[model samples]
Target: CAMASLWMLLVCANAAAALLVCLYLWLIAWPRWKRETRARLKVADDATVVAFFHPFCASGGGGERVLWKMVHTLAQLHREKKRSLHVVIFAQKGPKTPEQILAGAEERFGIDVSTEGGSGGGGSMKIDFVFIETELIDLLHAETWPRFTMIGQSYGSMVVAWRGFQTATPDLYFDTTGAAFTLPLGKLCGARCAAYVHYPTISTDMLAMVYSRRPSYNHDSAIASSKLASLVKCVYYFLFAGLYGVAGAFANVVFVNSSWTRDHIEALWRLSPAPTVLYPPVNVEALA
Candidate 1:
């Protein structure tokens, strides 16, 4: 058992070292990439940058509504403060141009987030789209990490978020896709990290499932039937839960989409005021 423990420790340590090496290489290129990205986008030096780390912001899903609404609201509020705001979206994959994405948002959500679209709502906020590589985005997908998916995707997200840092460093960052792993990355880049957590990466419900020895999507019959396997999964989930709590602690603010989400986030993260329940922006009037 002691030797088994040592082997596991070595594996985890090496994986962590690999991630660190990637981060180091990314940091080495960051300053040069930042300057180049800023110049290419024509971003002013003094503008407050709010980066939304949603690789699929232009997808126009429920999350996209929230994304566009936040863009509009933040733009409007900053205009009232007389501060120049630059909203940069780290889109997962983009063949569409920024104008095309903005047009899609307006067409789908009826929200005009364009600074130059002459929507009367377009204020002092300028918009830029930073398209991330498709391969990097796929790292967050479940198929990429079939075994130990929770931890796999958590570390995978850190890599994808690093790609965003290689583009432009923002004053503020919102990991709108529930990538809690990226919160620390944002903080490391000197940005005030924020998250709109739709669901926790590891939840107490998942823990309970493993405890009850239930076979479900996350756990197959083989693991559920074997007592030893269930015990191993329990330990994995417990350790992950602890690590997730630590990662979540780095967020400057957390906004959840529902009361259930709020309960889980609070239980895990234990924030001072608790994570605020900022439900997704849905257009009821438009539907009617």
Candidate 2:
């Protein structure tokens, strides 16, 4: 068992090292590509824009639906000369590609929009989606991405908040759900962050299946397997909760998707500095 533990630790350390190395190489190759791509695309370095940034915008969930709705609204707004939007999807690893998402949107909404993979697709006025996962750390380090609003749903949202906190990017972080460690990260980054949370965390819910104390529903498989490992995760969660408090305090705005989410966030961080709300959008007949 001890040898197995050592092997796991070694594997994780190696993976971290590889990621760092990849990030380094990506940054070095970015500038030349940026110059050539921009020249080809004919876009000036800076442009005014509003963006819908979704890190975890997958197929047809509430968050995905809301994001597409936002995109449609932005498209209409731009048509009427009311606004200029440059949507970006900084999706995480282990998700659909930008093209895949674009195809999905077209199929569902009958809206035809295409996104560029890199910073410059040589377009003058249009929304662009850049998929920046671990592979695009070079783009991230290049710091060429324009400032825009970032919207994340579920785990993607939490990751966006965490990345914002780590990189200090000038962005507005919006979370639709999965408000785990993100609030604290948003607060730390000092970004204009908001959460459209669906419900308060299970920690705040006495009747939650997660905290039933009955062994059956407990997700602590490590604990069920071994008392020692379970104890470690418990301690980890407790420590993790403390870190969440620190990160959440950085958010400037907190808009819960439902009353349940608001209550959960409030309960978890009773003294959080961010404002809370239930900001549901108007439901048109088309939505039905």
Candidate 3:
């Protein structure tokens, strides 16, 4: 009778474990990972599609300056009558239209992106703007997730990122902003991924704060004081740190803002060639 009961207990435990695995795949893996991707951006077959993933391109911020600068630089290159090149930016549609966004870039940052799409900058260069629902883009904002801001933003980015891919897949994917979550999506789509990161999603400083149980703006005092809560959070961060590193490694090139960022990305990414430090170029003329 004792042996039979022990056998029954082992069987029940195995069944419970199998059920949990099934639930995880059904709720998490299949929806987020197993879906197919499709592109909606239309372009000529021969043209090289270079897409910039900047959801807030019209914000007129420093990052927008950098984004438009690159776009303008490409526009200049297009004027040279070079090979077929199309620059498509993935942005969240706001009250402003795409044309308005271009005009704002010119007016605010003195960077112009108002080029003829069909004429291809008088050669074979073209520019286009893409967008999704504003709500999806809002996921990137910290305010969207009161709890687990880092993980929430990261997961929300994947939604935005995957949605962009479902709209269009570019030959080369560039993220002007620090949305590293999108890197893996580009990788999955067989596009070369690049990033200009001001900061990483998970950094050593964040780890130290959680480790030391220090309450700050990001860390709540309640969790910091409770040892069990702190330990739980530490585990969450530890697992997320692994995911962050894995996503970063998918990028072909990573450009950090400073040497400090370079050190962190290097340790996390573990790439063969270290990430290059690319400072944001100041528009001295506009600033003046």
Candidate 4:
């Protein structure tokens, strides 16, 4: 037990040293990453179809609403043009199966939601549902997935790393947070990448709030419960910023889901690309 404890201490010490070194490197290279990424931004072609990456977590939340709405809206647009749009819903499955997630989406998004001719949209578009738990690299290596535009929300966006595993590029990439600048979606997906950010991950204001320097929490209890966690998260982010730096720098375009999120994305990243506002849409007319 003593030897095990000693080994654990050594492991922790090594981790701390590595983290410190990485943090220093991130600080020194942050400016360069920003400059190089910005210089490469230019408008891309629109011929490529948009593939919205849907992780479809069983929790039917706002992000899923946004995705379903987007899919429906795009389908409506395509139907009007008498053309079809291609989409791929990328997800990871574990105890919560994809069928369960799909059922949840149906329950929330609509009962008619299916990969087939559902959602009141006709079979004009060929929709394929790929249920794979393989790494993004394996998906790329398999060469079975159709080259379509990629859009991801939350966890789905994280899979953009799969693009890096393959030589193919997406026509367009869009995500609402949980993407955190990995895999250079724009470059790797071979499309214009745009994301709807939910928050500024590494902003001074966030750090302040995290450090319990905010005005709201005067007691140590609040600090210990929440602010301290935020501070610790910020520290982790600081050390790991480089992991996502390349992805952020290589984004062709970006959009924030809310004003609050946009501010944070800008402040924390040190460079804010021309961000567009896309308020979450509601199906009011349908209800009416």
What C-alpha RMSD separates each model from the true structure?
4.5, 10.8, 6.1, 12.9
State which candidate, 2 or 3, has the greater lDDT.
3
Clashes (candidate 1): 1
List per-prediction Cα lDDT, in the order shown: 0.82, 0.50, 0.79, 0.50
Name the top TM-score candidate.
Answer: 1
Query: Of the candidates shown, which would achieve the greatest lDDT relative to the real structure?
Result: 1
Model 2 residue 132 lDDT? Answer: 47
Give the poorly placed runs of model 2, Cα more than 4 Å off. 1-53, 74-84, 92-100, 109-125, 133-170, 177-190, 199-202, 206-212, 220-234, 271-288
Among all windows of ten consecutive residues in candidate 3, which has the lowest summed lDDT?
Answer: 31-40
Give the winner by TM-score: 2 or 4: 4
Residue 22's lDDT in candidate 4: 58
Question: Model 4 Cα displacement at 46 (Å)?
Answer: 12
What ranges in model 4 sit over 4 Å off? 1-49, 82-84, 94-106, 111-123, 134-160, 163-169, 183-186, 210-246, 270-272, 285-288
lDDT of 4 by residue, 139-255 (tens): 333134332112112124445444321222235555543465543534443456666565544454544554554544322344446766556554654554433444565655666
Reference-based TM-score, model 2:
0.54
- Candidate 1: C-alpha RMSD after superposition: 4.5
TM-score of each: 0.84, 0.54, 0.81, 0.55
Q: Residues 70-118, candidate 2, lDDT per residue (tens digit)?
A: 5666555555555433443445555666667778877765555654333
Clashing pairs in 1: 55-92
Can you list the residue pairs that collide in candidate 3? Answer: 40-167
lDDT of 1 by residue, 5-111 (tens): 99999999999998896577557645466567668767666667789988888796898888899998887876675666778888877588888898999999999
Determine which window of 10 residues in candidate 1 has minimal summed lDDT: 115-124
